[model samples]
Target: MELYFLGTNAGVPTLQRNVTSIALRLLEERRSIWMFDCGEGTQHQVLRSPIRLGKLEKIFITHLHGDHLFGLPGLLSSRGYQGGTSPLTVYGPPGLKAYLDISLAVSQSRIPYKIEIVEHTGGTVFEDEGFKVEAALLEHRIDSYGYRVTEKDSPGSLNTELLKSYGLKPGPIYGKLKKGEDVITDEGVRICAADVVREPKRGRIVTILGDTRPCSGALELSLHADLIVHEATFAHDLAEMAHQYHHSTARQAAELAQEADAGQLLLTHFSSRYSSFEELIPLLEEAELIFPETLLAEEFSAYPIYRRQNGQLGK
Candidate 1:
């Protein structure tokens, strides 16, 4: 999976950055993308990328904050005008459905596809054969949440060398072997799939948190995550102000990544005061001190999550 940052600014838009929005593209695996948060101007941001609105399968809203949801209605409407025909599902806190309902109703916009709104109270929000999502309430001004997206473990590759040694050629028997079945070739040679196939490969884990203070929920969501996207709404010097606003500082976000043993941490939701690259350096420099794997997310930047040799996640 690849993560594309549409907007990373905190609270409001700046000349350099917009607001909170991230797209998790599973094109290679699932042929679709799942959006984490849709801040204002998110649809415009997607226009700047190769992202197609029609391929958006699901949208996960962390909270009902204006910056995180103001662009949702416009996006949903545009998808209808665009080529979106498949059903879409949205997961968020209780007020989300009402907000969208009123907004769409007021505008009298027409939607071409069905939209399913799920109001979650912090638990398993979604689960399918390929992936599962778990939500937990976070400490924020509103009822925000953090989501842990985990892919299901897949069967290991078939050992071609072992199959060749058994004088087996690639065919329907190979499919049977992948299913852990013992098959006999046309030559009547019995082959055991267990002896040729490798063990199952562990799935990748990703954690994406909404606007939050350093909390246990964030830690739980980030535990052993291959990649984590956390909000850093303030600089270390303004840590007190961050606490007052129920936001996290860069150092605080990094501390959570280190404490959770996350493989990599991507920090976003930057305060608008640090609009220039130079002004944001101090905030990121301090965070690097606590977690060297911490990365400052940039708009339009794409980070590919990979499984390292140690079975941990990396970018």
Candidate 2:
């Protein structure tokens, strides 16, 4: 899995950053992409990146903030115009359906495919064979939410060499074995899947949070996550201002990640005051002081999550 940062600025757009939008691409696992937010100019950002809009299957909105959802209407329209026939599902807080309904109706937009809008009130929002998504209310001015995505463990691969030795050529039998089935070979030899199958690969967890102050909900969602994408809209010294505005400072985000024992912390939704990389480095440094594996989200940048050779997750 990989993440594409489309926009990273907070509240409003700046010359260097747009707003809050992220794409979690699961092409290898599911051949589909799930977006975290749809800030303004998000479609334009997709055009500039390698992401294909047609592959977008789901979008999760953190809140009803304008900067987080202003681009949804246009994106849906364009997807229809571009011949996206596959159905799309959008999960967000309450009022999301009404907002989209009015926006599309007022613009006279026509979508060719079916769209499912789910306004969840903080619980298990989505679940399928491969993944599950849960939401929790965050401490923001509005009812903002944090999402936790947990991927299901993958089955172990069949031992091809061992199968060959036993005269079991690759075919349907391999598929059955991979599914942990005990099969009797044509020669009347019974083989257990566990004898030839490796250990199951561990699943990954990712937590994405919206605008909010430090809160228990954030910690719950971020617990032991492989990647924690948290907003760091202010510097360490501006903790008061960040709390007053219902946002988190870089230090606070790092502290939360540390408390949660997360593998990595990605800081995004930066304040526009830090316009350049030089100005933002201080915030990154402050976060690194608390969480050494912290990284600043750069617009249009892609971060890939992979398992290391030692059976550990890394980004």
List the global CA lDDT of all models: 0.91, 0.92
lDDT of 1 at 309: 51
lDDT of 2 by residue, 132-242 (tens): 999999999999999999999888877899999999888899999998899999899999999999999878888999889999999999998888999999998998999
- Best candidate, TM-score: 1
Model 2, position 264, has a per-residue lDDT of 82
Top candidate, metric lDDT = 2
Off by over 4 Å in 1: 184-189, 311-315
Candidate 1: residue 98 Cα off by (Å):
0.6
Give the poorly placed runs of model 2, Cα more than 4 Å off.
186-188, 308-315
- The C-alpha local distance difference test score for the whole of candidate 2 amounts to 0.92
